[model samples]
Every structure is written in structure tokens, then in C-alpha cells.
Target: MADSIAELIFIPAPGVGHIISTIEIAKLLVTRDHQLSITVLVINPPPTFGSGSAITTYIQSLANTTMDRISFIELPQDKTRQDSKAPMAAFTDFINSHCKHVRKIVADKMSQPDSGRVAGFVVDMFCTGMIDVANEFNVPTFVFFTSNAAFLGFKLYIQTLSDNKNQDVVELSNSDSTISVPSFVKPVPTKVFPTICQSQEGLEFVLGSARKLREAKAIIVNTFLELETHAIDSLSKESTIPMVYPVGPILNLEAGAGKASSDDDIIAWLDTQPPSSVVFLCFGSMGSFDEDQVKEIANGLERSGHRFLWSLRRPPSDQTSRAPSDYEDPETVLPEGFLERTAGIGKVTGWVPQVAVLAHVAVGGFVSHCGWNSLLESLWFGVPSAAWPIYAEQQINAFEMVVELGLAVEIKLDYKKDFFNPKADKVTAEEIESGVRRLMEDNKVRTEVKEMREKSRAAVLEGGSSYASVGRLILDVKRNIL
Candidate 1:
């Protein structure tokens, strides 16, 4: 019989960012070798909010080439109604309980005569339930963290959040400045620490996940070690095994494989503009802004004077809209007078071909929401950023990218008093102008940030850290599993 075809399964928590990253990983697994017949298993979440269903459609369309090699399974939705309070915990519980279903699916797949034996599994760190499924199959399971290495390291070591040594919340949040992590990371502000990584529940999840890391045969991060060598080194030293591999800036590499959907218009448009004259802005689907913040952003961009591309979506009901009337509303929306006033200088659209835009020579900097996908895209394109993180663990990511790595700068929001809330504070046109100007034109600032762009590009090239790690991961799978 022909050598058993290697079957690899991957499960990402439902989101475009996670789904897209997983798809790239799957593609790489096959492109690296012809012998592997890969199967990608996705767990579909409810369609009400942005879910994997949309991504499922997108991936299925790409399956014309893979045919029977790639397969998918949808999870049961949690329709049982409950109060919206503690939504985070509720959602986490729902996912945790879904492992039995995942296991059943795997068992059935293994029973087939022509079925490929499991070569390995790629489990999203958040979907720890997949660990049980991996254990049942007795395959080498690799945890795939779809975040920057610094962020992943912090998440893996989140137990530090429970320090009763400091009762002050302010002190705890800012501990990075005072507390030392030894030889690796330079101290940063606690104010930028992710709230999730700062809380008891969040800490428990992260630290517990670290323990699970000990059981896994490998841990793969979608980051290049050169970009986050200190944090990756720190994590490697602390872990039970040093099997951590940084095979990322993964999306760009996938793009290079010629598997990405073609969007030539993005390139055509960029050719018309002068070099480093455009600012591309977008937030992942999970991003949310109140009415006040939405309007503030619009006014800010309008005043920034740079040629711009803004991807605007319907802001949550609480957010204000000062969107101009000329732009479409609700869907395919843009503000009124948005395109006219900045006719030669701006293009406002609801969704954009982000990778293509960033790759354009005209694009100089980014005004980003700090989504990991966007972060990776920026690094890939060697672009600096104006970071405005909203919700989730983005604050932590922003700090690492900006304060720690110096690849981006923060757009600080000001309030009248000592007590401040992002929901209440407004970012005016003036603040926007200042931040944008600094990112695009400040000589000293621009020079330093430009160096980061060069470093980012070098990190993913042929002999680069990410390239070597991906090679090592593939070889390890071949030797240990196949």
C-alpha cells in the first residue's frame, strides 16, 4: 500500500481572524509536501454574530482543488436562553462543553477503511477542549496561538494576575513597570496590560493552558522569533518542553504560496498614488465602537490631511455617527462629503482587500484597531501604525507592538478628570491630526519606526526566523507522526 496519507485536523474558535489564520496553516501543510492529504476540521459557531459559517463558505469554495482531502464539521449552537450578564464566562462554558461532540466526530472519521490516520492536530489555544480529542486519538497535538509572541507569552503566564501582594488595581495593572521579568522583557506600563490577563478568571485560564502545554508534543505560534525573541525565549525557558516554534507572519507566507484570492484592483489603485502617501485603516469584525468614538474617529481622519482609506462598519447602537451623508449608510457605508472633500486624498469604503492595500508602495502607515491579523499585515508590509485598541485583549497587544516593539505609536484619548472611561471620552479631530502627523512626518519618529519595518521584513525571509521554524515544524511532524 502507498504510504499512509497524513491527516491533520485544526479547530479555531469562530472568527475571521482565527479562521483565516487556520486556513493559511492548512495550506502551508500541504504546499510544503505533496505526500500529505490534509483535512481541516472547523467548529461552526452561531451565525447571529460574526461566526465561522461565513468563513466556512469561503473555505469550501477553495476546496475545489483539495476535493476529498479537506473536510469540515459544525458544532451544535447553544440556543438555551439566559441573561446576557457574564457573557464571556457563558460563552467559554459553551465551548468547553462541546469537546464530546468533537471527539465523536474524530472517532467516526478514524473508523473508515480509506481514512487517513491522524498525523497531528492543530488546536487553538482558546479551544482547550480539543486537547481531550487529541488525547483520545493519541496523536501529536500542536497548540496554534493566533497572536503575537509577546501577547501569547503573557497569556501563558497570566497567573501573575492573582498577586495579592498588591491590593491596588492601579498597581496591579501597571506592575510591568515595577516588577521585573528577568533578563528578557524590558518593563512596560501596567496601564496597557490586557484586562483579561489582569483578572482572576483570565489568569486561571492562561496558567491552566500553560499546564496543558506540557502535555502537548508541540506549541506553534503564528509569530517570528526575531520579532519577539525576548518573549519567546522567556516562554521557552519557563515551559516544561522547548518545542515552541514561531512560524509566522504566517498569513503573508500563505499569500506568497499563490493560494490567496486575487484582487488586482488594490494594486492598480495604489499605482496612481505617490510613494508613502496613503494611510490604510480597518478593524476586524469583532471590533466595536460607541457613537461618540465613531464620530470622533471620522472627524480625526478628516483633519489628518493624509490620503486615506477607511473601512467603516455600522457602529454599535451606543456609538454616535457624524458620518457625512454622501457615503452609504448601514451597509457599504461611508460618511457624507467624505469622498468629495478629500477627493484626491481619500477613499472610504466599508470593506477592503487589506493585504493588497498594505502591500502597495503608496501605503505608508496604518490607523489600526490592533487586531492580530491587522498587526501581522502591518509588519509584513513594513508599515508603521497609529494604534487605537478597543476591547478584548487588544490593549495588551497594542502595548507590546507600540511600547515594547516600537513598531507603532499609540493615539491616547484624553478626559477632563482623573476618572476616565473609553466610552465617555471623545477623540477629537485635533488629536487625530497630531497622531497621524507624528506617524507619517515626524523625522526622528519616522526614522525609528522605519527601522522596525525593515526588521519585520527580514524576519520572514528565506533564512529568517519564521522560515526556519516552519521548516522545523514540518520535519518534526514527518519524523514523529508519519
Candidate 2:
């Protein structure tokens, strides 16, 4: 008899962060069960923005190298709605527009005699609409949340509370008053809540996804059990949602492997520095600073009198653009003579291999934007962070890291307001300097982060929580197939 097969479908959103995380999960699933195969449905993003090229390249590389069991199918784009008012809106529109094509493709594949039997659909949290497609095909569906468990708990709790009064949570007052969330120890101050809670479109998007999650067979979060035990416990207790699976720290270490070849100059420079004496500053792909903020950061770095490696980029001309790719000359953005005076102690580049930098022994501090992926990488490497959130749900992540986890120092506790208001006051050089000093000087935060790093690494090892969670997920998929 022919070998039995278990195939799954993954529908990810149109950004680099989402695609990267989803791909990592797919790879992990296949590694854990050789009988399993993954068919990732890709959406053709507009030419101006999105991660189409990167995803295409990665899939092509996979086809030529390892992961032959994985395949990709790109959906045609709707040319009429290429332009959107915001990145979030654009992503939402793309998923809604292409979900029908995804369904058709999945159905066609299932009809083929030699094709593997479809067992499950793993949909990104942003692409939760695919759940309907899975239901139509009578396949079990799982929502892959590409964030921490605490954030998931926050979203579900807010949705439940808001439904009680038939009122939208985003429309609530943004005062300094605090509200209790299910899994958290202390009431979260309204000011540090997710920025989405302040916008109608964002709130609708989150609540809609949360509602969809309730119908899934299970929800897989990109976080481990030990990291957020309370949050995972809270989710597990809720009868409304599906089973919660904590299988994470799913990271792409390949980018770090070729660091010496791809970033020889930077690595060489770092080698000359003293042990644990350099600070590394890197925001996510979408992270950048205005001219004023750039100057302040330059001044702050110079004044801090520490060896530094800063990944600098100019802010996008369009605020709603997906990610910043334009590289600006350091002299153009930094204060006059700032580069010359700090040449001996600092180096600024357009982009660097972040994982490699964080893993290096010479690096001791990370000044980050508090994006979940970056935060995970920093923790995995045992580097203390100076939290500086920019957009999306980053503000909430920063607050959690500083207050709940005690693993990081805070630069701006409530930066979402300033991020949305261009004319808002910029963070001063003194504040940046103080934050950097505190992160580099504080031993308590460093010790805590080191312990978390060990836990993170241990969670993915053979006998770890994440390892067992992956096994459970694979077993669940196989049982569903039968």
C-alpha cells in the first residue's frame, strides 16, 4: 500500500513578520512528523509594499534545498484595491479579497487522487477568515497566533468584557484609570493599553479575529508555557475558545549562521570591542525615526560614552508603507560632526544581522522597538533591553516586559501616542542616554533576562515544554486525519 500522508494548509498575512513566523512553524511541524506536509497559500501583495519578494525567495530556496515536503501556491491579486489608507487596513483587505481563491485552491488540491489528504488548516491570526473554508471542507482548523500568550489573553478578555455591554472596547475612555485583565496580576493602566483599543478599525479587526478564534479547534501561540504560565492558564480555563497550544520560540537561526560571510566587516569591528561592552540598536523592518528623533538618538549615543552598533534607516515617505527599505547616509541624519567624533566608539549601518549581534559576547545591551519577534530574539540571547515601542501592539509588549517580567528597562512607557502624532514631542537625548545607561548598568534586570534566556533555550530542547507541545500538535493533526 502507498504511504499514508497528512497534509496541512497555512494561510499567512502579507507582511514579512507574519510570513517568517508562519514558515518557521511549518518547517517545525514537518520536522516533528515526516508523514506531514505543508501547503502554504501565498497572497500576491501590491508591488509598492508587502513581503512578496522575500516570501517568494524563501520558498524558492526551500524548494532547492531542505524542506522538500513543503510547497507554495500564490493567489492572484485584486488590482482594483491596491492602495489602502493604512498598513493594517491594507493587510485586512488583502486577506478578505483573496480568501475565496485560497478556498478554491485547497478544494482543488484535495480533489486530486495522488495528493495528500487534507487534515487541517493552520491560519494566521490575521487570516482567521480561512476558518470558514476549513469548515466547508470539514477539516479541523487551528489559529496560529504569532505573538505571546499574554497578548492573546488581553485580547480575549477585552472582547468578552466589551460584549457584555454591547459597546466597542476601543471607544472606551483612554484616561489614566486602570482595568483588570483575566490573567494579569495587576490592573493595566488605560494609558499603556494596546493602541488598537483607541481606534475603531483596529478594535474591530482584533475583536473579529478573537471571535473567529473561538470557533477554531485549537489556537497555537508562538510562546512557551513557562514564559507566561498565568496567561496560558487563563486561556485554558476559558470555555469559549479552543484548546491552547504553547509551541514556540520558533525562530529562524539561518540568518545568524551566515553572519561572518554576510556581515564580515561588522563582525570584525565587534571583535575589537571589549567583552559585554557594546550596545546594539535595531528596530524591526518597519521601524525608523524621523529626522529629529534620529538626531536625538545620535546625540544620546555619543553622550552615553559607550561602544555602539546602530542600525539606522530613514523614515518612509509614506507612513502607511509596509516596511522601511531606504538607506540614508549617516551624515545626512546625524548631528553635524557626530559621526566623526564618535567613529572610534560607534558604528552606524543601514542593517545588520541582528541575531548574530545579540548572540555575540561583546554585546550586552539592546535598544529595541519591542516587537514580539525582536523581543524573543533578545531574550533568547540573554541581552537586557531598553524598551522603546513604536507601532502596533508594541506598547503593551513593552509594558509587560518591564512591569510583569522584570526583564527589561523602559525608555518610553507610553510611546504609542507620540508615534501616532508626528508633531508630538520627541524623546530627548537625555532620556535616551539615561535609558541606555540604566540598561547597561543595572545587574538585576540582566540577571533576570539571563535566567529567562536559559529557560527559553531549555523549552525547545528534547524534553522541554515546547518540544512536548510540538509533539502534541503533530499527534492531534494525525488523529484528525484518521
Q: Write the per-residue lDDT of candidate 2 for residues 1-482, one digit (tens) a residue.
A: 23579999988876667787888999888877888999888765455554444434444444334356888776777777645466456667668888789888888998899988898999988888888889999999989999888888888877887776576576563666778787676677777777767777667777777888889999999998878888888888988878989987988765645633538888889999998899999987778887889999999989999889999976656633445654646688789998889989999987688888888899999999998888889999999999998877788788888988888998897876333344535899999999999999999999999999999999999999999999998889888666
Candidate 1 ranges with C-alpha deviation above 4 Å? 47-69, 75-85, 160-171, 174-178, 182-184, 197-211, 239-242, 252-271, 316-327, 330-340, 413-424, 443-462
Worst 10 residues of 2 by lDDT: 55-64
> TM-score for every candidate vs. truth?
0.82, 0.93
Best by TM-score: 2
Query: Tens-digit lDDT track for model 1 on 63-116?
Result: 343543455555555556333524445556666666777777778878987787
Best by lDDT: 2
Candidate 1 achieves a global lDDT of: 0.65
Q: Tell me how many clashing residue pairs each candidate has.
A: 11, 0
lDDT of 2 at 457: 95
